[model samples]
Target: MPVPRPFPPRPFHGWRVVQAAFVLAIFAWGIGFYGVGLYIQTLSASRAWPVAWLSAAVTFHFLVSAGLVALLPDWHRRFGIAAVTRAGALASALGLLGWGWAPHPWLLAPAAALTGVGWALCSGAAINAMLMPWFDRRRPAALAMAYNGASIGGIAMTPFWAWLIAGWGFGAATAVVAALLLAVVWPLAGLVLGRSPAEFGQHADGEAAARPPPAVAPAAARDRAALLRDARFIGLSAAFAIGLFAQMGLVTHLVSLLAPVLGVQGAGFAVSLVTVFALLGRTVTGWLLPQGEKRRLAAAATFVTQVAGSLALLLGGDQAWLLLLGCALFGIGVGNLLSLPPLIVQAEFPPAEVGRVVALMQAINQALYALAPLGFGLMRDVGSTAAAIGLALALQVLAGILVLRRPAP
Candidate 1:
């Protein structure tokens, strides 16, 4: 296929489509993903649930979310992305409602797991596949912006949830959030997400359904077999796993931990502030992302940030500012990590295969990510919370060291 010289490449309409996707992505991430951490303190206080059990719920949430990503590619191939996302949104609403009103611990755990899976469908695996045809040159930055939606949601929802729980209680809050999601995001997806910018003839792929979309990474590189054999992929994946490990373990109980650091009253504000910085971190790093070699560069940056964030966790203070710094660094690094591996996967595979292959990687690593929290919580059960955090940080340091491979530069 020839690269036709369009008079002005992509125009305003293309940007409109990408912006729509970006908004939808942020809404999904905020309400669906980041919102979970906000509920932990309230849930625990109301039920007197042991941290370990709730930790399992968190693990199970990731398990379901990751499982959906691993499975949804085949689903999309059969049912289409729009259909799957709509179903995901509806399912998520159901799960969220169940979570807010459930009487038993068993009920809440399963409800959270279902929502996790639903989120996986719309936001995790399906998002990139949906946006592939929108813009050519600025996909990563756009994706970065989209992924930052969760951070925004996290920042925004934390205080709102705190207030809702304080004002009307958890049951009413959940119902309100669920109803809003059903009313807002579901309809938006129906209206805005059907056609990529390509359908409008103002995209990198033009209006031709048969035209190839812009590749995810610089494709003028080695073949898959050769690329896999390079060891860089392995190193990068390991480093990313470290970040995921830390993120999964800590984020599950962030509110709980911060309460001790900054009283129960201030914990919500602290978490929200951290999320605000997290969103800034992603936005800033995304702006700094290099045009070429985004894969390796991201791998390197993820290694550094995870290692640094892990080391910084020991810096505790009753004041909110220090804890906020830790969360910001961790959030930014992990958010970018979500976008990074897909770049390599995109480089190595076609657009159709991007979701599936990335799902494969996610399945392998997500299990590891999920287990970190469970294990850490068990250690905390033994009166060794510090020890648990220490072990996680050590593992991250080791992963970072392993990331130092000598590629053919």
Candidate 2:
């Protein structure tokens, strides 16, 4: 009998990177994104800050972060992902602590801005840049697994912070959360985000044997100005800008919207449910969909769901079931909002240009979404929750239409 050849080992390292990215996503979104609503509430109660002012600070946070994110490609090339993430972790920790302990309300803007810096480094843009090189054939699955951390963050941390703030006060609760963030994120950034697969003599998806790298087309030498002139980029940016504006606006106000009707604990539960459905939606899409034209369709469908959810919220009144249902439906597309934009860019753009394109897209998306909270808060201040939510629903409907437009072949 002929001797059997030895089987090669599976590539496990890439998965390690995925795992670390998952943890990083949890911290980044949990503390920076979902936690914003809680901060607004706490500051409103403790410091008597108006909702609009607090919401504006949140907008400022995103504006600054968008500028930082626009520079991510150059930053990664110069300093590497690990260094970038490390700086982000430290900044996030310090910012959180500052936010918790600020004696005067005036300090909140700067603190929020600092936290924004951390967010830019740890957000989806950073996650995509880190994981893209490690995954190809499995890119969808890897991204789904990592981005789901955002949902998990909402599920786990929202209630945890709500409870912690209730029990220990905002200052103590925030400090503890910040400490935990540093403890978890610093080590992971150091250990797994240090290098890409190629740097360690591996290929994407951890292929067991070495093979010649695939030939890549030389990226267009056009600068950001030329890229801005591209029709496809403009279409993608406008679609997502409107979509995220509605989504983020609703999310920022979700807890407050439900609190009067559902009570604080009930509102927290609704937010968690939204996140649970978001996780489910992203996970299901990853398993069911292929990686190309279908992405836009999926994203468009999700936007429609958000529109329906917003309408439900507008009409639900004080009915707990309707509110919960609205949150669940709205959440069906939440995770996809973050995941699809990058995937679409990957599909439409050249591999060499993916980083810059993704960065620019993120910047525009952030800039527009940054206004969501301020606008929503202003509406809430001047009108009823239903009216504010109705405006958001309209925005989502418009976004859905924008995204549904078929691209030229």
Q: Please report how far candidate 1 places residue 282 from its true position, in Å.
A: 1.7
Taking the tens digit of each residue's C-alpha lDDT, what string does model 2 give over 13-108?
888998899989988998889888789889999889887778777778788899899889889999988999999988888888878998887788
Model 1: residue 326 alpha-carbon error in angstroms: 3.8
TM-scores, in order shown? 0.80, 0.91
* lDDT for position 40 in model 1: 63
Residue pair clashes in candidate 1: 26-149
Q: CA shift at 381, candidate 1, in angstroms?
A: 4.4
**RMSD after CA superposition, every candidate:** 5.8, 2.8
Give the per-residue lDDT of model 1 (tens digit) for 1-409.
9988868544445455455566666656765666666556568888786655665676687788876677776787788666787887787878888778888877877787778877777774576766666644566666667667666666566567778878998889888877777676666665666665545556452443445645665445343355345454556566667767766677666667778877866766655655665666667765676654555656666657755665566566564676666666665666666776666566545455566666656765776787875666776788665666677677766665655553442
Q: Model 2 off-target regions past 4 Å? A: 1-10, 209-216, 381-384, 406-409
Weakest 10 consecutive residues of candidate 2 by summed lDDT: 213-222
- Candidates' lDDT values, in order? 0.66, 0.85
Please give the distance, in angstroms, between residue 373's alpha carbon in candidate 1 and its true position after superposition: 2.4
